[model samples]
Target: MYELKIALRQILSRKKQTLFAILAVALAVAVITVMMAMLSGFQDELVRSSIENNPHIVISPQDEGEEFIHLYRYTSALIAKKEGVIAVSPKYLGQAALEYRDNAEGVSLQGVNPESEENVMRVNKDVIEGDLLTLVHTKYGILLGDRLAENLEVHIGDLSLIHISEPTRLRRISY
Candidate 1:
């Protein structure tokens, strides 16, 4: 008690120094509080954006060197039967080149069952130009990204050629 009293007396006697010290501590606390709030807001936004853009879970082939998932239909059906599964859309991804007139651009092609993809991704909500339901009836229908469509100078009814190369063979398909 005596030591604390002596310390208090010293601080009280140096009024200007004590006031400056108090202000410095207050400024540090305010800056730290503001930085913490900003960090929390940033983290929350990052998590929300990641959740919105990605699937809850992704299932891929277990083998590190495997290029494709074998028996994907059976696997997908089994996964769908598990608890808490709302939908399953199996996709086959390939690299292809799109050719329209003289323009050619390489792109990644994804083959998906349109109805199943719609159930899983709600893709129809983002369709701006054509009916996604057309894919159900159109035997050779394809959906392209806006940037790809723009780059290829293609419109709704225009035909485009796709060339795909595989290890065993190369195939060209027109749509």
Candidate 2:
């Protein structure tokens, strides 16, 4: 068409300006490509870390009114029977205050069946002092995270007082 020829002539006439515009578009596209790659890389790394650090599947209560222990007991069996599950461990999680002689910090307390816990989560190897499996049947025995232990200024055998929030009231348990 005559219009196509005229447009081509116009672009050819302003060579420097056309080149600059093309370069700008190329630079913008390159930036967008790099940003997209970085975002995808970040997402992949996050998913990999989560998969490596946590369980493949977590079976939790579906409703707020159900007790966590009830959910754990029921789900443990169901998980054990599931096709892809290698092992199952009952989990009990509660919020408590970690206390030492003078220092205290509120922490999330988790009770796990250690013999089967290895199948679910990779235990941190740098834990300095306590046996991870020692709390299997030990009621009132609490395992503290490294940071939490440091905050409370306590060692493994040292006692800690825990204050928990119940449905209707607060209760204190010494560990």
Candidate 3:
């Protein structure tokens, strides 16, 4: 009771100071609450984008020295039939040189089944122009990034002849 009376007396004596202190605390709480909300929203967006932009699982070649997975179709079918498995997309990734006219530029190449890739990668969102899903119906259709299109001086619907480079192979048996 005495301590409470003393605290009340001190607070009453410094009315402006007490009011300002209360206001300062409230303002601090408000600022902190807003910051926390913003941070939470930012974190949620980051997680969502990370999930959307990347595949949850990737199947790599068993042997690092091997350039290709020989039985990918068989493996993909088996994996797809597994329980709780959502999407299984087979992607062929390589480095190639594309040539148009007299200009040639080395580029990373990716060949994927548009239908299955759509289910796994959600690749349609990344396309700035043209339809990625349309490739399912269009046979021999290819998608090109802006940088690659610019490098090759090609436009949409323009039939630009491109040359792909074959990787040089050198095999030697260990004695």
Candidate number achieving the greatest lDDT relative to the actual structure: 1
Off by over 4 Å in 3: 96-107, 137-155, 158-164, 167-175
Per-candidate clashes come to 0, 0, 0
Report the C-alpha lDDT of model 1 over 1-175, residue by residue, as the tens digit: 9999999999999999999999999999999999999999999999987876566777877897786799999999999999999999898778888777787899898787888888887778777778666687766677877887788777777777777774322222212
What tens digits encode model 3's per-residue C-alpha lDDT throughout 73-120? 999999999999999999998876665567667878677898899889
| Location of the lowest summed lDDT over 10 successive residues in candidate 1 | 166-175
What is the RMSD of candidate 2?
Answer: 5.9
How does candidate 2 fare on TM-score? 0.61
List TM-scores for all candidates, in order: 0.66, 0.61, 0.71
- For model 1 the local lDDT of residue 37 reads 100
So what's the TM-score on candidate 1? 0.66
Q: Which pairs of residues clash in candidate 3, taking residues 3 or more apart in a chain or in different chains?
A: none
What is the alpha-carbon lDDT for the whole of candidate 2?
A: 0.70
- Each model's C-alpha lDDT? 0.79, 0.70, 0.77
Report the candidate with higher lDDT, 1 versus 2: 1
